[model samples]
Target: MPSRSAAGVDRRTFLRYTSAIGVTTAITTGLTACGGPASNGDGAKGSGGSGAGTIEAGLSYALSTGFDPMITSGATPYAANMHIFEGLVDLDPATLVARPTLATEMPKKINATTYRATLRKGATFHDGSAVTAEDVVFSFERVLDPKNASLMAQFVPFIDTVKAVDTGTVEFKLKSPFALFPSRISVVRIVPKKIVEKDVKGFDAEPVGSGPYKFVSAVREDKIVMTKHDKYNGPHPAKAQKMVWRLMSDPSARVSALKSGRVQAIEDVPYIDVKGITGENKVESVQSFGLLFLMFNCKDERFEDKRVRQALHYALDTEKIIETALLGNAAPATGYVPATHPDYRKASTVYSHDLAKAKKLLAEAGAKDLSFTLMLTDTGWVKDVAPLIKESWAAIGVDATLDIAKSAAQYAKVDKGDFHALAAPGDPSVFGNDVDLLMRWFYYGFWPEKRYGWAGSAAYKKTKSLLDQAAGLTDEAKRKELWGQVTDLVADEAALYPVLHRKLPTGWTTDALTGFKPLPTTGLSFIDVGRA
Candidate 1:
């Protein structure tokens, strides 16, 4: 089978494709534990026990997108889907380890290019419909359909077809022998066929799934409410009777909400407020693959030269940026993936802070007195780092005008090929933890093809070839070797590369919640968490 390409998709499709998989942004807050059942301004009661009370959380991202697991890219909705949907296999909220959720166990290998899984008996969707082989087959089919243009399609390009072998068993045929097939399929969450076909738009607005929680209601930029799926017969059942997720994008509001005991937990704890929150609550910062990357428009003459790109990367005082801006909560990008990742391998080309090297590279590329508008998203964290970035570039004789705006606006300029360079936060690790998935998110798909204008470059072709080779290999060591090579190539090219990987800081009241843990990814998860 030939490798999939994004060549034929139109401009509108390209925009939707990029927007549907918009990068997950970082958020932060602080919480104080309440001694008993906590009551919100609305008189909603929250506490911990089986089917006992509500679990109120102050989420950072607004409802920018819908709830469909197939295409929803907004961090808050994606996190909400964790409670409302499940794949044949689902990753543990805390550890990110793939485990059997709707399936009886992990998909069993039938051959080099085929695998089969049996549904867990008695598992039913939140709407009281039994989850069957048809549902699983339909779920994968919609995502695999090119006409549907699912963002998830890019991740599972190896899949040839999916069929229901029986009412309870589903089979998958891959075009190539993929070693990570079991865990990789976790990207496509299973949804009921009849309801989706009847009303996809309605389904997108309000989702239904076989997880521990059922979608109740969602108001954009306000709150999302859900009730426990009492019929859920899965391993991780909802511990709280109800859940109220208050969408508080303002860091101060989230902090105040948590501190006042209106919410039990909050994520994306502000780096500056970490110390203050730590004195009264449990604040844990987990190093994640989430990163602030610098992307160059390879189509632009000034940035088309790889040396110019490399020079810009070398110019940044990453240590100072992390120390002053992030409060030392991030690590400089040594590789495409974070050092904490299991499959992480040091890239051959590590860009250390060297002003002299940066200047030399600029001169070699004939980019003397370089001036460009550095576009960036107005995410709170990104805004904090914006001036520092300009200062770093200024030291190397580069006049960088910072153009800061919301993610949508900045990305609009990027999508139209109207921008020079952009520094933005992205975390694709929320989908899966494998190196292939992580690297492919930025390097392989619509990102390089449309957003960054590297699709026509020889380096992009080389990176694609290496990734495709790695995907087809069954041998673990050989696959990783190929991945390492791709990592080194991208790092050296520096077309669109990570500047630093951030530590996802989360704050929660220790005595207010049980079985709660911080995620390394962008969103919060309450899979097995309960209010106390």
Candidate 2:
């Protein structure tokens, strides 16, 4: 996005009008509370139960899910869990390039279908076994083993086999051609084969890895304490052991915690609270590419009409949503894919607010009594955006209904085609527009063969074949060409609609935090977290 002209950070007329009414436009609130950290949410008290060297941080989700990298990796917003694990390649601070963490170098492609990788000799797991090729092979294989239930396994289905050629060397034989294989291997965090072989539940509770930080202790759904791994490889970490993670479920509670110095680095700063929350001296907010969208179930007869879908798009007041709901931190969306992705058509036309045009389209389709069910989780972010959508559709005479999938049933509902429209937090792509990324979340029959309510209908069946064909080809230009073809077709069909790319915002309390960067997975990790 730095290469393209960044748009509209300044206040707008609508924003000015909203400010007159006293509202937060994904705005920020001043946080000037100064003191040692305290625990705000319900969790085990003290920095650590033992009151040892621990750096305290706050997160949006409870720490019930522990440090099993493969369990909830990128596909979910569990960067905090990933913070406890180290992958083969870590995101470089200056370049944003994938650099080696466990492996010696970028994976070397022996041919169109095979890659050879070598392990970093001195790297050791916390249990002190030299990290070997076998561990890397086991981790990758286990994730793709179907029963492991890894959410981010779709990218590497072609991985036919992973054999440790030697203690330090391994081979990955793919079933098809993949030019971006190295990028795929970069994020798979290595686990000790010995530990997982014994207890899956125990490993999930307390896992060990060769990351910059080592896990100290964790109380399920409450908080986690991590210390700097003194034997960490790569650039010596600036932080010395002392990091604590407190789980704050409510956005306002997270804000209050930051104000009270109860925790450092809170996640999911509501757009309304971005400016005022980060206004504090210690808090710094980073606005990276966030993807948010309202998915249309292709199976539903109501949304199957292109005119009906287009009409819904025409009804939105995107600017107002940003001003009132998101505050001012988010940009309006037009494309189904993220605007920041490499292949995104930056100059493409945007779907601006047009009430008249929406009415006309609906009339043309004889879509007089437009009605649909949009289901989302019961979270603050969903509460803010979904109601705004319902009201916007109502203004155009569309009888839209808002539904809440009970917290426990939400994931199952979305993963299956059980709901009409659901909010999806798609994983961030390093290569940006890899075909797999787009084809998986949308389109008919999602990637890794999960049927999470894709646009499944007669119209989408044709599109899916073309998409599959594109994935099989290795020609870069040809691949880009196919991606454009599918995206254009989807847009022309109005098969999907984007709300806005969801952003993860956090504020730090103590300057003790370092090596913390905005990650693709919007969770906090301790790889670089430490007391100053």
Superposing all C-alpha atoms, what RMSD in Å does each candidate have to the true structure?
Answer: 5.9, 10.7
1-532 in candidate 2: lDDT tens per residue?
1000011011122233223323222101221112223333332233332222455666766532234666432111245444446566665532345677677888888998988887777887766677888888898888787655464465567689989999899898988876667766655778889987886555655667776656656554455555555555654341544466676667788888877767656766666666676433244444444455556665667766777777787787877777777666566665655565566653243567899989998898888787877776555655677778888899999887788644335545644567666553333443233445545445644421243234445557767777677767778788777777766666667655455664456666544344555443355555544434
Q: Using alpha carbons, what is the TM-score of model 2?
A: 0.80
Error of 2 at 261 (Å): 3.5
Local distance difference test values of all predictions, in order? 0.82, 0.58
lDDT of 1 at 422: 91
lDDT accuracy of residue 177 in candidate 1: 87
Q: Residue 173 lDDT in model 1?
A: 93
Q: What is the lDDT of residue 160 in candidate 2?
A: 90
- Score candidate 1 by TM-score against the native: 0.92
| lDDT, model 1, position 41 | 34
In terms of lDDT, the poorest run of 10 residues in model 1 is 1-10
Regions of candidate 2 where Cα sits further than 4 Å from its true position: 1-54, 73-77, 92-96, 235-238, 278-285, 346-349, 405-407, 411-418, 423-435, 447-475, 509-515, 519-521
